[model samples]
Target: MRRIAIIGCGGSGKTTIGRQLADQIGVPITHLDAVYYDDRWNRMDPDKFAALQEELVAADTWVIDGNYASTLPIRLKRADTVVFLDLPAMTCLWGIAQRGWKYRGGQHDSSGVYDRITWGFIKYVWGYRRDMAPRVRSLIAEYAQHADVRIVTSRRAARKMLTELKAAVH
Candidate 1:
């Protein structure tokens, strides 16, 4: 499938899955974190960020990863496939901690955002299922009605989906 959107909370393994899916499908990948944050985490102008996303979506095929909920419709409209990584909050929180440890030295992330785990980020992850999931699901229903939606709730399920995708591709 082409023109995919991988969305989830802050630490839901969106980037990791996006990368693998892009590699398997041989398409370009865009991390919206990279689009939203600039050097030193300076936020990009909302207008500019939307414009950039528009340009990216114009491409014939791509795998984009992020959950900028406000702008989700932009990507969802163009995506033929949408993957929601609906993992447990605890799993996501642990993922953030693990990612922070791995990228502690301020290494460049594929998202171009070398972000630290802040209390706010933690809270966001903790509240995602309760607060964000409904909104995202609503948006999916509204904007991506025609797209194939895959809700991945566990790591094992995700791995299985990826394995099946890879097998299909090969």
Candidate 2:
């Protein structure tokens, strides 16, 4: 596929895979988080963010990661395929905690990469899947009506995806 989008509940490894996918394809990436979050943790205005998204998603090829339903429709329309990091709730919580720990210490984010983690954010990530999962799944189903979407429902699946991608690139 020329363009791919990675999405999942918080801390599901979208950014991580997005980077690897982009590297494999030898194309640019758009990290949706960096576009959404300002340096001080402030979010960009909706209008400005939508404008930025217009530019980023308009590319000929991109590996992007994020889940903004309002913006997702636009991205999904252009994406040839989607990779969903649908790990279990427990796993998602643990991952979110780890990522928060890694980023809260003044991390960097550019090109849709979150280079930092925070303890406080970890707790939020560690929980809330009960509510988040349904919403995420709904979005997936909605988008899948027209987009090619694959859900990776376990850690094993994630590794398998990496291996498959490696083989595909070869």
Candidate 3:
């Protein structure tokens, strides 16, 4: 795929999966979080965020990781494929629990965001997802009409998403 974007809630493994897929395809990749999050977990200015994303997505072949849809729509529009990790809240919680501890233990994500999935942090993102998810899903649903949007909602179905990526775009 020339341009792929991974969208999902926290702990949904979008970054992890996106990196694997990007590496398999041998293309450049960017984690929007790294570009957006400053040292204290504060966000960069919207204009700056948008500018960086716009510049990055101009590349020929790249996999972008993150669901910051506000700054992400342009890339979404340019994307040839969109991968949505649609696991439910509990599933996301479980994934966060599993990954967060690893992150606390010094694991770094491909998206370059430090893994700091504390219980408090996980709880916060979980709550935040309630507000954020509908928009993301709607975005996925909206984009699916114009482009390829494949969603993986279950653990068992995860690899099917990968296989779709592995298949050459015709």
Best by lDDT: 1
Worst 10 residues of 2 by lDDT: 108-117
**lDDT string, candidate 3, 12-76, tens digits:** 88877888778877886787777788656787999988888888888888899888878657778
Give per-residue CA lDDT, model 1, range 1-170, as digits (tens): 78899999877889899999999889867888777876677888988988889999999889999998988999999999899999999999888878878888375465576766677888889999999999999999999999989899998999998887678677
Q: What global local distance difference test value does model 1 have? A: 0.87
Q: Output the number of the TM-score-best candidate.
A: 1
Q: For residue 135, give model 2's deviation from the true position in Å.
A: 3.1
Candidate 1 matches the true fold with a TM-score of 0.94
Q: Which regions of candidate 2 are displaced past 4 Å?
A: 100-104, 108-128
lDDT (CA) per prediction: 0.87, 0.73, 0.76
Q: TM-score for candidate 3, please give it.
A: 0.85
User: Ranking by TM-score, best first?
Assistant: 1, 3, 2
lDDT per residue, candidate 2, 22-127, as tens digits? 8888997777777788666688898888787777778888888887767776677677778878777688777766766766644544553554555665555555
Cα-lDDT of candidate 2: 0.73
Worst 10-residue stretch by lDDT in candidate 1? 105-114
